[model samples]
Target: MDQNQIPYPGIAHTIKDKKALLARVRRIQGQVAALERALEQDSDCSAVLQQIAAIRGAVNGLMAQVLEGHLREHLGTEDQTPEERRDNLKQVLSVLRSYLK
Candidate 1:
């Protein structure tokens, strides 16, 4: 993972941990499906709320993992120029704004 396998820093760094990320995604998907099933079954409101919370937490965790990877690849890569690092920072800031909204 230290050696950049490709020029696309955004996702290239994830190659080393793709399996783990995919597994996290799968679990999130399962949580979402369970939430859907609960809705379909007219489950208790508290149960539904808890499921939604769990889904949100799982998604946030996944985002954190990918964002960490993206930062490490772009900001810490020795070959990257200052301009490139600034651009990466801007991209991250933009995404954070959107995510927070």
Candidate 2:
């Protein structure tokens, strides 16, 4: 989408959804705490692995959601000039490369 077609309200969009996002984060935190407790309690190896997998999935889901919003707000707009769009996309790609690593 171009800058003119920007569907999201940028940070305001995130702020509006902050409560829901925070709730998800809290749930993930709870899961992490549970994982810690399981380790402390000498849970079975398989159980610990399951907990780790759950945490990873949760984190990945969160990352995907945030990335979607960021792309929409920053790179998917039609308002920016072509040059600006290219620059923004490059920056986005750079961040993604670093993040993926």
Candidate 3:
């Protein structure tokens, strides 16, 4: 069966994946809370910038994991028609561009 027609191994047991993603999201949540507290406290600009950098890194990592999972599940195999392949390629490029932004 084509890769797209089959479930990804990670997706099949996605409880683990979900938990990990949730953990990252929760940490980001905490970061946001901390940032709010920092703002309330009028923390230094440098300190706020550092926290923002950390949050950005966390978000990028999470996006990477999600993109990897999607590529493996949907783009790891062949397409039966040129039109279908072009469409999939377009989708992949669009997602990549969005993530890069």
Give the deviation of candidate 1 from the true structure as CA RMSD: 6.3
Best by lDDT: 1
Compared with the true structure, all predictions reach lDDT values of 0.85, 0.78, 0.73
Candidate 3 residue runs with Cα over 4 Å from true position: 1-16, 78-85
Candidate 2 deviant stretches above 4 angstroms: 1-10
- Residues 1-101, candidate 1, lDDT per residue (tens digit)? 22422234447878888999999999999999999999999999999999999999999999999999988888778897887877777777777777999
Question: What's the TM-score of each model vs. the native?
Answer: 0.87, 0.79, 0.72
Top candidate when judged by TM-score against the true structure: 1
Model 3 residue 12 CA deviation in Å: 6.7
Model 3 Cα lDDT, one tens digit per residue, 1-101: 43334222334424548989899899999998898899899999999999999889988888888777666555665743666555555666766776777
- RMSD, one per candidate, in order: 6.3, 6.5, 6.6
CA shift of 46, model 3, Å: 1.0
Instruction: For candidate 2, write residues 59-98 as lDDT tens digits.
Output: 8888777778777876787788887677667766765776
TM-score of 1: 0.87
* Backbone clashes in model 3, listed as residue pairs: none
